[model samples]
Target chain A: MRAIVLAEGAPYAPAPLSASHPLPPPSPDTTLVTIHAAALNHRDVWIRKGLYPKIVPGSVLGSDCAGTDESGRRVLINPSVNWASDPRAPENPDIYGMLGLLPLPGTLAEQVRVPSRLVHPVPSHLDFVHAAALPLAGLTAYRAVVTRGEVKPGDKVLITGIGGGVAIFALQFARALGATVIVTSSDDSKIARAVKLGAAAGINYKNLDWRKAIGAHGPFDVVIDGAGGEGVAVYIKSMRPGGNLVVYGSTAGSEVPLQIPIVFLKNINIKGSTMGNEAEFKSMLELVSKHEIVPIVSSIVDGLERAEGAFDMMKNGNQFGKLVIRVHEKHHL
Target chain B: MRAIVLAEGAPYAPAPLSASHPLPPPSPDTTLVTIHAAALNHRDVWIRKGLYPKIVPGSVLGSDCAGTDESGRRVLINPSVNWASDPRAPENPDIYGMLGLLPLPGTLAEQVRVPSRLVHPVPSHLDFVHAAALPLAGLTAYRAVVTRGEVKPGDKVLITGIGGGVAIFALQFARALGATVIVTSSDDSKIARAVKLGAAAGINYKNLDWRKAIGAHGPFDVVIDGAGGEGVAVYIKSMRPGGNLVVYGSTAGSEVPLQIPIVFLKNINIKGSTMGNEAEFKSMLELVSKHEIVPIVSSIVDGLERAEGAFDMMKNGNQFGKLVIRVHEKHHL
Candidate 1:
């Protein structure tokens, strides 16, 4: 099978996935998927650069995929495993990990095998490219906004770092749920784009007084923070008493300094969340389908051979949404 | 009415409350109570040094109390108002203020008047001193341990700085709910006393590596922290994935530095809570009655005249449990 493999020294290579079927499913309860499209995430860039943990040379490298199964069902795979029964956390976290690492075949290949339970029908509104874009970022945003934030109709939501795929999804999902969405981005154009995409307001956090500026618009019900509280004091200050701040990721360094007294005084809740469970993955897809929310595909490169181009675009960090690799032409199983 | 009023410059005076009908209940639905006992909180200490917000000089200055109401019902005041109908927060935070300041008379008095809704039946097991200790600290702990932490039976729980009133109540409440409670205090004597009081284990956080030392006992399901996360990284490191870290106050300085990545990667939650709402206060009382959990009272000063001594002891922070002022000899109403 053709796939993008992590090669020795030179990094990502288009190679034949061999060595006695290392990519094959370990169980009979699993099905093979002919991947039509796969998306690039920061994990792929990190693995390629030897920045990620437990990297295996010659393993196919991609976590998000849209494909056709043996039953010819249009599907997208849940990127995680070993957490089907537990909604709060994986039942056994020691064995829990996302796909694309060793012991789990990546979706960058022509075909990949996975547990049948990890496969779900793709939202009816999306194609292989957009569906491939949805799983990892969409599920993460869903957990932060709906599951953790408890965003209701008329709730005020603030999503930070607007251009990233996850933040964009948070904005769209919060809006879909009838929330008044606000976004923060250092780039004015990104903020403008977000405002155009139905956000009630946008703030370029580059300004020294952006935090103070933000307070005028809020007393927000929920703030979706991708970075930890580098601006935590400001975030909590803008929150209503008893408001919730759901943090999904942290780009900030080791110690995120926060004004802890405000949290004590204001009755604020700070929850840390990440990749969601299987049930949340299903709910995310349902929400996408019901609201006709399309995954924002910032850039797409054709052919499995051109997967690195998508990776380069993602690494450059200017893309507003997902970077996808259209792997197969027709993918007729 | 004889009450402990905040005297100009001198501080915490047991002066006779003069001014025409100032201590009388403003509404027809309110009741007047003859206070048998009153308790001191850190807020009382902060207000004494002129450090707390919205200080109303000459106002009676205490929050926790147990007394006999006009109907001969033995009761304790809820300490807060405008939040009776709102479970999550005060309906109008602008009007939301606890007793012990102007508009709401302090509990350190011969008699206090309040809305009927703010008064609750005292636990059958507790006398005036213990019941007086229960309201503020007990309500705060109940929110941190049960309402926010969602601590379940058999859960391993961590309660930090266990010598203080709120932390001690958290220790007892978590234990009463069938959780394995562990405590941390700088004083070895305090830790020993907490273990004797029913904690499963104790660690003296005075040790330089107490944070790492704590890991051997847990993988805690819930951690009740009175101080904000000075040891947040260590706390989250010892938390089970999807565990909750509830922060109720910050004894540490203004800024709390936390390892943000661990929170994001571990699926940990850090919530900020203070005094609970009316429903939570009722629930705390019910739990106390059902379990016969007595609020630990360390020192009892007799009569409103000696109220300043209770304030001084709380400020010094040498006590292991609540410092209570026994306001009156048994009152027949």
Candidate 2:
């Protein structure tokens, strides 16, 4: 099988590809997926650059993909594996499960093995590339807005960094829930795109004080922050008393200085969410299927051989929505 | 009517006292409580020393008191008063209501008027001083642990600075809920007292790294933090994944420089809780009554004349529990 294997930690300019690798047979309760399309994540760039120390030298680096299994059913790979079994699962001892992070290999290859439970049947109406984009970023946004933020129909929601994958999803999700969505973006084009996507307002953070702009919105009930650092403090100040601030990523920076007195005085709640649980994933898929909400496919590269180009486009932030690598020929089962 | 009034804000050594002021008349549906005992809280000291800028000259400064109303019912005053007609009243506002920092007349005087709803029936077994101590500190602790923290039995709870009023109540409340209480204090005497009051473990923060010390017992399911400043970073690090860190006050100063990465990775929750609502107040009182939990009264000062002494003792941190002022003779009513 042809796979995009990380030979050594190097820049994207040095093409590193393994055309032939032995593919392992699927173990019991595991299905072997023939990758139809795999999406590029920022994590893929990080893993390939050796930014994450935990990644082994030869590890495949992708978490979102849509493919066909041994049974020839099209599905989206739920990349998040928990080695620790769900405490709620009746048959299992409390054992940890794994998603894409550890001992299990990632999705950026010709073929991958996953537990039957982690693969969900993709709706027949959805294409493989679009289905591949829904697992990681979609679930993350679902958990941030729906599960953690508890976004209500009339609630006012603020999505920071309008152009990012999760932010875009949050904007759509909040609007779909009947919330008034406000977005902040440094780029005017991105801000315009977000506005076109049903955002009530957009602030070009480069030109205006987003804090004052958000203040003019008069205190949002929920603030979903993808841009961390000092931006979080500004967003926190922009929240109404007893409002919630859900943080999933700190793309700007990690260390943020906070005013503890103000936080207590306002009685705010700060929650940190990562990815969604399996139940949340199913619910998100259901919402997408029911609403016919299509994931914006920025670009699709042909073949697993072009995976590096997809990674580069994502790393450069030139692509909007998600970028995918079509691993199999369209007519091939 | 006799009242403890600060003619001017100053240190307790030259404390001002005035007694010739007229008692406030009770308005519609209000109660005139003949103050039997008024507790000296840290707020009183802050108000007296002019640390609180809103406290005007001749302002009465006390938050907790228990006495007999005009109807002869034994009652405890809820100092957080808000006008019943205020738009925010639908939320069942507090006595002082949402304006927590404003200098409202306190409960230290021989005669005080409170809205009918702010006065709660006292348990017959509890004396005036004990009941007076339960309003501010007791309510704050209760909200931090039970209402916001949602502490459960068998959960490990951490209380910082156990000698203070809120910490003492938190220690008792967590213990009453069957949680394993771990307290941190700089004083050995306070540590000993906390253990006797039901703390499973006490760490002298002065002698050891509190985080390391707590790590031995951790990871704490709930951490009630009043000690702010950089110590909050340590406290946040001490919490278990998915645990809650409830902050009510920042005694050590409010600036908390934090690492946002740690928050997202650990999936922790940080909530700010103020003094509880009327429902929470009633619930706490019921718990206290059911458990026959008498507030630990450190000392009692006789007469309004000795109110200055009580204030000084509280300011100097010399009291183990609540420092209360007995405003009138036992038979005066």
Candidate 3:
């Protein structure tokens, strides 16, 4: 089996690619997934560049994928695996699943082994390219907007950062939930595009006071911040009392100076969410199927050979939505 | 009428008491409460010293008090008064009423005018000193432990600091809610007292590896941090996944370095709560009446004349519970 294995942490310029990997047989309770398409995430880029200190030399870096099992069952892989089972966990799978950060191997190869329960049946209407994009980013947005944010119809939601996969999904999910979606983008074009994608308003964070612009929207019930920093504190101030701030990714920076008194005075709730639980995943998929909300696929690279290029495009910020790697030939499959 | 007034922000010794002023009359829709007792909180001390920049000079400083209205009805004053009302707020006469901060004068005076709705019938069983202690610290603890922490039977709760008014209330509240309470205290005698007050375990945080001691208790479901600093980050790490950390006051100083990834990975929630809402106040009063939870009153000083002495006791950390100022004699009417 051909796999894009990183031997060492190096810049994408060296274009290191290796081809002599053997596909390991599935262990007990593990299902072997023949990868058809895998999507790139910012985490993968960070993992590849060794920004994640735990990444070893032999780590396979992708977390989101869709493919078929040995029995020819189509599925989308849920990539978060936990060793300790929480009874309250949404998915009570028999074995650990694909949580890319831990000891579990990721899905950037031709074939990957995951716990059977982690694989959800993809709707027949959705193809592998779109299905592959739904696990990590989609679940993150789902958890942020629905599960954690508790966004409901008539609620106003403010999503920070446009063009990022999670932000785009958040906009669509908020819209599907009947919320008035507002988004922020540094790029003018991205703001326009976000508005076309059902956003009630889009703020150019680069040119205007995003806090004042978002304040004009006045007291959003929920604010989803992908950009962590002082910006999160600013957004928190824009929420009405009892409003929620769901923080997932902090792409901008992490050290945010916060005024603790304001948080207490306003009675604001700040919740940090990662990707969604399995129940949330199913709920999102159900919404997608019902609403026919297709994930915005920015670009689909032809083969696994161009994995480096796709990652480069992501790093250079030239891509909008998800960049998928089609690993297998349709005729061959 | 006599009042403890700070003509300017200065040291306690330099700040003199003013006694020539007459009691202000009540306005329409408002009642003049002849304050029978006022409790000294850190907020009062901060306000007097002008540590709180928002408080203007000559502003009376106490936020918690119990007194008799012009109609001679015994009442506990709600301190939080925001001018803007949320229509969705619950409907109980005491459900959304508070007098001291905004839209109302501060409570440290011989007589203060409050909207009639801001008054609640004090539990007939509790005296003025106990009722005064109940509003600010008791309500903060009630909201933090019950509303924010959602403590339940068999849940393990970690409370940092023990001798302060809120921490004492938290200890009582957590135990009443059937949670196993663990507390941290620097004072050895305070630890012993906390245990007697229902703390299952106590850690002297002055010692190193306090986290290890806390970790030995396994993961806490809720960690209430009143002492802020790098110590809170340690407490946050001690929480189980999906656990909540309710921060109400920061006595240890505010700026603390945080690891953002730990927050996301553990799915921890950090909520800042001040004194609770009007509903919480009424609910706490009911709990006090039903459960017969008597607030620990350390000392009750006489009127505005000795108010400075009570404040001094609170500032010097000599009091185990609420240091209350008895404003007037019961037979004065």
Give the winner by lDDT. Answer: 1
Q: Residue-wise lDDT of candidate 2 within B1-333, one digit each (tens)?
A: 666666653444264556576667657987888888888888777766677645667766678889888888999976555533221111432334521233455677777776778889987689887998888888788888987788999999999888788889998998899999998888889889989999988888777576678777777889999877766888777777667888888888788786776676666778887776667777788888887788888988888788777776876885678888888754242
Estimate TM-scores for all models: 0.95, 0.92, 0.84
| lDDT tens digits, residue span A1-333, model 1 | 577778866554434333233446456999888888999888888888787678888777889999888898989999988777465677889889888888678888778889989999988889999999998899889989988898999999999999898999999999999999999988999988899888998988889989887899898999999866466667888999889888887774546777767876777888877888888898888889999998888988888767666777888899898899888745332
Measured by TM-score, the strongest candidate is: 1
RMSD of 1: 2.5
lDDT of 3: 0.77
For every candidate, what share of the true interface contacts is present? 0.80, 0.65, 0.36
Ten-residue segment with the worst summed lDDT in candidate 1 chain A?
A14-23
Off by over 4 Å in 1: A10-26, A252-254, A329-333, B10-26, B85-87, B329-333
Candidates 1 and 2 compared by TM-score, better number:
1
TM-score for candidate 2, residues paired by index: 0.92
> How would the candidate models be sorted by lDDT, starting from the highest?
1, 3, 2
Candidate 2: interface RMSD equals 4.1
User: TM-score of candidate 2 restricted to chain B?
Assistant: 0.90
Q: Which candidate gets the maximum DockQ versus the true structure?
A: 1
